[model samples]
Target: PAGRFGAKTGGRAGSKPGRPGAAPGARSGGQGGRPKPPGAKAFGRERFGQDLGPVRAPKPKRAGRPADEIDVHNPEGVRLQKIMALAGVASRRVCEEMILDGRVEVDGNIVTELGVRVDPEQVAIHVDGIRLQLNEHLKYYVFNKPRGVVSTMEDPEGRRCISDFLKNKDKSERLFHVGRLDAETEGLLLLTNDGELTNRLTHPSYEVPKTYLVQVRGPMAQGVGAQMKEGIELEDGLAQVDSFKLVDSTPGHILVEVVLHSGRNRVVRRLFDAVGHPVERLVRTQVGPIRIGDQRQGSIRVLGRQEVGHLLASVGL
Candidate 1:
């Protein structure tokens, strides 16, 4: 490498045969008998006021942009709980409990670590070798709950519920309802393991807007919407409807659209009862950033990403 440094040689390959000038490599001889070294301590480089070939450096590595930076194809983005939930195993919280209980294993090793990150597609996560993380593609399903089905995952008495309705549903992953609905109500229900969004929507602190369409046993009247809007006192204290408008009405029945920030159990029914018009049938027509929009009962549809983003933005999630 030192010899390859062109600074030692003249512009030509070798030194002149018999000249007073310096040789190519050795810079002729010392000052006592010949020209001094071009850059020796004894004779400074400015002594001749000339520059030789540069210190060769293998072309300086071309001085270009970097390679092997971020690998976009890396598959280590999914959280462990999410992976298990999406594998049709259980809910995220249940998955965490299993992991902590030492029931789940990843790569044949029982991984009890919480919040572990792994490649869902590449790594095999198993609970008793039952293969988790197989269907973990961040799935979402909206179910139109019918009456008589409990809104939760399971019941203590084992009554016929929504979970039964979803028994033969798309076996993509272990999904659960976003919020809850009373057994006598029929309405929109979202199911997914997107815990962050679920927390925002379900937590009463969020006060997310929920829209309900109620068929009440009453006559169409001008003051009914006003009475519902002015607020009414229930066992849970006073609750107010964000908006209440008459949809269609008859002498014995009235269909009214009611929007509220409360997801209380039987909230729509209770609100109507507080106004002296107990609801005969309560059906949720819309949820925060979601709606039925002609979706039939017991049917399911995947929510779009933009819809999810809008929901997040709506609640400042």
Candidate 2:
């Protein structure tokens, strides 16, 4: 290892001892000619102008829009839970539970408190990490169906359906009937896309009330209302009216008002027919707080906010 770095091997014949650059062996293997293979030396701070330290991965791009990008200053808004309920995510009470469980979010921030208010028109909302589409223009309509028109949006046989009346409405929201009525029955049918409200109105657990006006024929049976209230056995199951009354009567026809919570198909007609009377005409008069009022046949109108409010209140939504 004596001349490992091309140090002079003492003065050679006619050689400049201190100047290894002048040696042929040094030119071939030492610093005089061939480079030290560049990075053969250990790295040092002087290698570069500045200390970059250790390389790191780039900061991850933010997951979503930043909080500052959201308008926290929205002045007019409704309770966050109520907004979720209206969005059909859940009932307001259940939405509160979801919030408390950190499953609800507004503008990317998990909101656990029930008191948070949100301008749904301005803010983004989410539930269980999925973005929620808040229908700012929530729609509720009551259609006064006419006889011979189906209660559905379409019929394969070209029979007139409820869409005939709603197709020309100003709004374009897709609507569904809360429950079905046969082609011969009509009136006070609800059309809405409010899923939570619809569920409560139609679900058996809620027992939301429904009222019907029926025209029947045949001799009046004694204590018919009382007998019907006690329940009658039908092909599907037992059916009964919550309340029934004879509104008016002629020699051969009688008008009766019946209220019940069952959503059984054709239950009213079957109930009356079982008691010696057959229904000639049927019209739904009310569903919960909604009524046909004087709404003309084949007409439709958006429900008022107060009416919607009353309906939600009745169902604890």
**How close to the true structure is residue 271 of candidate 1, measured as C-alpha lDDT?**
77
> How do the predictions measure up, each by TM-score?
0.56, 0.60
lDDT by residue for model 2 (1-317), tens: 22434553333323334354455524322334333333343121222322234445465532444333444424367888888888677788888778778797677677766656678877767677555655556678889999999877878999998788876553367787888889899888988888887888888988989999999884687889998999998999889999998899899888999999999888999998899888999999999988899998999887765576577667765
Question: Where in model 2 is the C-alpha error above 4 Å?
Answer: 1-135, 169-171
lDDT of 1 by residue, 1-317 (tens): 12353454333423235345544434333232444445434222222324443343343222322222222213346777787777557799898778777787666767666646777667656675444325445566678888888887768988866567664544446676888888888889988876776888888888888888889887755687787788888898887899988889787898888899987777788777766788788888888878888988877788764465456556663
Candidate 2 lDDT for residue 310: 70
Q: Residue 33 in model 1: shift from native, Å?
A: 86
Candidate with best lDDT = 2
Candidate number of the best TM-score: 2
Once model 1 is optimally superposed onto the true structure by TM-score, how far is the C-alpha of residue 18 displaced, in angstroms? 76
